[model samples]
Target: MKLPIKIALFLMALLSVMAACTNKNASQRATQTNTDKRYSYEYVKKISVTQPKKALQVLQHAEEHKLMSPIDINILRSKVYYNSMLDYKKATFYAEAALNDSDINNRPEQLMSLLYLAALEYYNCGNYAKCLNMADRAITTGYKYDNRRLVGQVLTTMGQCHSEIGNVGHAINCFDRSIIIFKGEVKKSPNWNLYYALTTSNALKANAYLEMKQYKELFQMKPEYEGTLNKLNTLPEGISGVNDLANATFYSIYAIGYEEMGNHAQGSALYDKLIVTRAANTPEGATFVVPYLMLTKHYNEALSKVNEMESVWTRSGKDTIDYNYIHNILANKAKTLQAMGRYKESLETGIRAYDLNDSLNRRIKAQNALRVSEQLGKKMLKKHIERQETLLRINHIANIVIGALLVICIGLMIIGFRINKKLKAKNQAASTLVKELLLYKKQLMDHLAADEANNAKNNRKTLEANDDKQQQYDEFLRMEKMVIDRGLFLQPKLERSDVAKEMGISTSHFNELFARFSDQSFTNFINDLRMEHAAKLLKDKSNYTIEAIANECGVPIRQTFYRLFSKKFGMTPAEYRNVVADE
Candidate 1:
């Protein structure tokens, strides 16, 4: 296993060069030093998801005062935009700058990671040529560094770019290579993420095979990926988006494959699984719902879903939404409306879809993108220093040694990237605590439903209340649990009538049942259900942002969710989560 003498000598000389450069430029690390580690990676990551503006401001301040090394500042900026803001253009810009900077150009591993980010952002922006170009460079960097993880990662993105452009053969080749690399790495160290990566590669490969109607390859994929998922299920807590990514990758293809094979029953069953998962909560996975809605003739829900998707993309957010996907959704809406015999409506929708298609083609072909001004940040950073009000925040930002920012950045490349979410990790699995909580929620609902049904009927009908005629109050509550079990409580406009219909009771009778038997009013009852679910969601460690949690709990307006949650639980959602974590 020894390297040839020339290769060995070259590696030694390379190390010597790197060491010399580190010593030479070590003093040139920071321009103006931060006395208080305010712009540290740890601090930025803490605020990145929930308070993106604050995180960005802190980063600007750090850069303004020369608080961090140049490379560190830009890298953090890239990741915050990429992961939190979902703004791909700014992410791509910063990532490209970081790679080209004198501080990071010699660091192969960091280069590998940054290259992947830039390529992913390009793909997001629908710049296929640029995406492929970045991926090619990333692949080369991965090989140069002998980083199997990076190589596998970039190949997955590369394959996706090909798949997007209809180059199925090339896509399949890239996917297969990525899968092989991932599988080999998994054998060395088994983890859910690696398995997830393998599953993603397989899923993309399966899609390509399905497109070509190569059922044989597709058939082989089912067992292998299912087995991979089984192994993943046994592993411990992963980073945010495991459940979502799993559904979007393996289960999505599984459903589509069943549909393609004409086994509508099996496909429908899998489709239901997606509805229960967090698939609809995300833009990428939300598209999967449309096909099932169309198949089931749930035209109204399908239209609502399309509009919701459109709103999500067009909202006052900096993130780039894929117009190509939006066009597809529009086309699906037109078809759904046609099926429902809404001829005039369908014609208007079809026109919109066609116009969007033309617009998308122009975008993809032209790939016009705004540049992130490198100078604006410098000016803003310096201007904001006099106004900086940071007193303390030690565990994260405080621990980042300000004077040793460059050295710290280098050390973090080994371990801090995982924490920064830039490093990704050795191979973490979904945490056991997260698994237990998820299972507890599902099992708790199912268990309580049966237990309460039996108790409501056999044990106690009324709680010795005044003016209580024999009401099915217990029964009303039981059926409400059914509504929540079906995730209907997450509906913002869900009315009392909706639950009454589900319960096979009259709306007036439903109101009386709550009025007589329950201490809280009907509205309070619904809010309580949402509040309890919000608590569970907060406890569940994942990428459930405050906004996402509010939306998930049938409260889209952040202020409303906060107000109702405070009334129900004495503390804000953020405080409640902290309390639980402390416990």
Candidate 2:
């Protein structure tokens, strides 16, 4: 009996020891899993900016093992999408998910980061209003979290949004605030964020001053910009990773300012420097494209450079072609061609630019629509959560109320569907009308060309019957030289009689001489000269508007100016101006 009792006790002791060991092993596994998850997250964060593809792979591994929480994984995915891939749509998706996640609602820093990322994506998409809204939320979140660096970053972004929308004063003010905040933050050590904020803010401020034509203020900030650049250069490359962008932006601004100030030589030199530096660092990307376009405006070999840019773009991959950059390049090419008096080529290039601009505008509108839908969804979600809480409190009545609400929602959805269908039909009709109008315009242009050719032939025949044809031609040449040399075609109300009196000839003789030698009447000849001058004036994009160009060309009636220009060029004055201005 004693032996059996001892055996039983030993078995009981063994069972207790085994249970203790199992519990300890389980605890150790949980701790190891948590540590692995933390290390994975850290690894991903470290590589997200420098090696995004690698970061993404690690994040996938973490996700597969359920190492990170859903909210954390979503945020990581957002960063990878945005910083690595430049995929704003996917970035926004993950960002929105992370923001809406209940686990992260109280995480102020995470919320602020998400908001800032969204704002940046919106800004890149040209949705300035939405960008501003996101920026404002980020600012609020920054203050709530007492994150000065975050506040400064969002303020700089706000300044950019304001500048985009033509609120230069507001933009400058925001930049100033951001600069002050960054200056304070940089008192400890070389903080890359603070340094970037300071330089970018100052750069933006200088740009605003330049835009407002406050050259003195812009020049005053020159030393500050240079000093900031020097400071940025001192930072390690890992910390100041956007060095190429910073350098390109600074030099480009100065180049533009110099050009605006009529120091083209200095501007051209700066642009050359920018281009060379960008080539070494950034190579064939957006930064390189800026100096390329700026140089196109100032250099004689613009067409060659443009062709090179196209080659670079092609090599960069067609999928990555920035529409805005393409549009700007084409527009610049058109301007350069017009300046070189290649009007036909300029006109064709200008039309392409217009089409691209229209497409880009439509894309921006769609992005804005998405932003608005996001806002609406947030509002609806809040209401939904409130209603859910109310339903839980009144469980007995909840079913009946929910049933009635469901029926109402179904009816409203049906009405919405019908309205959407009607809208679609109306939009299609409008689009068709636009197409028909375009077709009619094309046919009208063909008719005008035929009429112009026939009129030229008839006018030549009408003026062929002169007794002393050679002598008459010599006198006509003298009068033509006088009219051109004196710019007589610039007189808006000058009649044939006025021109004849100025030329010391009878009105009929003057008209006949022009018809014989110039293949047109005196009036038509003067209009031709005026149209040529108008086309040149249209190329000076900064110096004249369409109305101003018309006035300068002595065309008092704007409608008549359009009509005659269309007759002469096979395109309206606005269209011609669009082409010339694109150059």
Candidate 3:
């Protein structure tokens, strides 16, 4: 059953060539790095809904354009290649790419790249042991690297990997550690990662409790979990300007948690809310539609919504990631069709869902596989270091035993020592590079701080300017009060000459002075003062109807009430009164 040697070698040669073609330069890698920060999750989610070819093109564009940083790009490239395309070989390529260049001077970013690549490899191969091993490396590296949040994230991922592989005790341990870390740091902020991490840890904890039949404890966790979710919901909509995937995920998880706690009605309501929110925010034909998956039971309605969403996206050029939405709805449609005895239609819809799932699995696998491969590479490096040390010891022993060989060995040893010295120099050089990078990072941070300080100063100056303007308004008020003391604007049909007489000035000089001081014509100023007083009188609901208030304030025309009120307050007198009543 073995292939002939010639054919086998030829196939291997072809693969090697293909691999070489996909290897990218740093700029191309940089594009992926930037995109990773912004779009990695969206790409993964999109895999469930979009065609593999289209997803591949998206990754290619990022790579070709050099839109992201190298480490970020490698993480994303590995993920997109592995998960969406199911190209394990390319996934391995990018994971290794990420690992090789992951030294960011800052330990946190380096560990993050390592963590991503490790997880990608493990999940793709469905190798839970290796996944945990990689995740362990990430957790350990995070500890060594002093990034508590990354450590928590790794622990959560480790828990999920164990849960998948049926290692309940280990999963519980991982989840417990993750919860401790999250409680220590993640609770203080509204980070989306923190929310998801918390959800995963709680979900795992609840599952463990469920397994132990500790129903009371499981029930108790429900309210705390829901409270966390409520806090998440109330957070100011983030400035990211896209639908908040983390919030949507919270609702989805809460739906599960609530249903398990014997709150089916609440669970269903959450699901409905998730669906509505997603529909409103999601773009058409864009691949992120995880929220829509819950509505599978309502297949016809879901498909209609999907079509509507697709139409909107198409018209507006928006991307939609809804693979699960498509699969779940189509599956439901197939089942409904089958129940109605329409086997052919059922088969057709089922086939569509099946095909879509294949695409989804490919994308997930690609990203996961890269994660696993990166972990293995780190283990290999650790092993290589150990082996080198052992060899050096063996050579030292050999040199002592052979005296004639000792002289030549001593010279060789001197040369080897010199080479080691040079390598140390290179290591120092690397450290220098790291220092320079850190200094540059500090400069950028300082610049940002300075810019912010400048902005604050400018804002304060603007406030002072506004206060000056308000002071001018106050002066106008004082002048109006003096005129009021002399009984201007009191007549039922107030005239400018009456106002001038009240102030004891000629009409011409009175008009000029009033206009110069108040920045309004005398006639206009008098009418406005009358209107302002009339509006205040109208607000005294017990004493004054609109007509009575208008008469008392010396503006007797009832129709004028409508015009003046609308101009001054943006609503009619009746409407304003109704608004007050509601308040």
Candidate 4:
């Protein structure tokens, strides 16, 4: 009886302990839930443009405490940096982090936002192809989710990319589509976002028209642009909350349009407004350099104003200057200097601008090569998978065939496998050769730049010792040597017109240079290089046939090759080979 009573008391004590443990867990869970809610609210809703620094502190605190979703935090961080601080690199980093997060794989809305932001950052970086690719992805995702606003934004960005690349027609089409979508969204709900999109789209369209020299279209759009500007002004300050750089761009385009339409007074007034309203120390004010340039082209005090603006830009620090933007600034500065009769300074600035432009072009080409390689890799992977599936199917059929007709099937399969192996080996070798060729081409381009610079220096010394006519003759000789050294004549379709364009000289000038220097026409000069290369190849006892060597030397027809070789070298290709053998 005493044992049973002890067991009952022990059971009651055990149940009481269990109840206390459950209550503690419940309280802890409630506290965690409340903390999560608070963090989410503070990071996502309570944060404002005016309080980005404080918002960043809250974000850091939340991150420290491991509250809220990581993707959510990253997205917010990207927005804060992009919208408030205008730090595109940091913004892109966070946006890309959000994109690469596994947590957002199934969340289309979040993924779409990250993609659109990434596209914008790429556009800012001047990676137009990557920008277009990301914009396309975002547009597809947005359409799948039936999100019109996201689609409109991506389309607008796509338009900007096209505009940057000088695709005016495609740019106009994209802008129109985005404007239509934004108009529809506004019709449903009159929001500041939609209004901003509409205004920016129309402004970009006008800018495109300006680029295409469609003055009639630009004039037609002027009244509409004015009306939109008026409406935009009526909105509360920062209500649209769009990119201030873009806002400044819209105003600049408006002013440019007025100037193009011969309203110099109105254009001047608008320029004054832009200069005063957008402080020169700001990013938006960096765009003011455009108007100042235009003003300098027409007005008198513009040079002093541009100088002041340059001081402001320098004070803002070099980190604030974007690569492409600075290139434009230097170009405009050079032009302004020329207008002010500062020829030496203008020439130096122009050379700097040209060098920067060339660097940017080379970078763009390298990026394009990388992109193409990636796409080819994907295609090759897909083809490989398909080939594997096909081989498996073939193997299955071969097994069946072997059972039905053993002897015949065995022979057929052996032959088929051998052929397949040979083809694969050949393809692999071809691919490797192609890759090596691309590498060689890139190396050749680098060597070409260095050679051009060296040649320029040599020619400058030559010029110092020569008269103006003699200097021109020397320059032509240097250019001709460059063309021959690069083997440009090996291009079968290379023409005098093309070479003239490459040299940045008129066709008539090219002809005059050739006549004065070589005493031979351009055709004879090209033929001479081909004959020289052919002679060298023939002497080397290369495996190439006469016709093949001729083709390689840019003479396609065998008869024509013989005629040119006999005329230039005093013998046929075979006779040249015989003489080379005797030597």
**What is the per-residue lDDT of model 3 for residues 421-456, given as tens digits with 9 covering 90 to 100?**
775555445434533654564475566556546646
lDDT, candidate 2, 1-583, per-residue tens: 0111111111111111111111222343345446764435445654665576777887787779877667667877876666545555567678788878886665565677678777776665555666787888988877886878678777767776776678888988987897888788778646554576677667667767866878888888899888987797787643213555567666766776777788888887887777666432332233333333544454455566655655665564533324434444566667668877889999998887777666765565555455555667877656645754674568658768989999999999999999977755554454345346545644755665565466467755554653587658657756765666688899998787887899888999877887777766667878877876675566555466678888888997889899877676566666555444443
What RMSD does each model have against the real structure? 28.8, 21.3, 33.7, 26.6
Q: List model 1 lDDT by residue over 285-360, tens digit each.
A: 4466666566567788877877776566567453223443334556666777898899899999777766666565
The TM-score between candidate 1 and the true structure equals 0.51
Pitting candidate 2 against candidate 4, the one with the higher TM-score is 2
* Alpha-carbon local distance difference test for all models: 0.64, 0.63, 0.53, 0.64
Q: Clashing residue pairs in candidate 2, if any?
A: 334-583, 335-583
Runs of candidate 4 with Cα error greater than 4 angstroms are 1-58, 80-87, 235-250, 279-283, 296-322, 353-583
List where candidate 3 sits over 4 angstroms from the true fold.
1-69, 76-93, 102-108, 120-130, 168-173, 187-196, 203-219, 233-243, 256-264, 279-583
Question: Which residue segments of model 2 deviate by more than 4 Å?
Answer: 1-62, 65-77, 80-85, 238-240, 264-269, 276-583
| Pairs of residues at least 3 apart in sequence or in different chains that clash in candidate 4 | none
Error of 2 at 174 (Å): 1.0
Weakest lDDT window of 10 consecutive positions for candidate 1: 1-10
Clash count of each predicted structure: 10, 2, 48, 0
What lDDT, from 0 to 1, does candidate 4 have? 0.64
Estimate, for each residue in 362-394, the C-alpha lDDT of model 4 and write its tens digit: 554554555455657877656645755785688
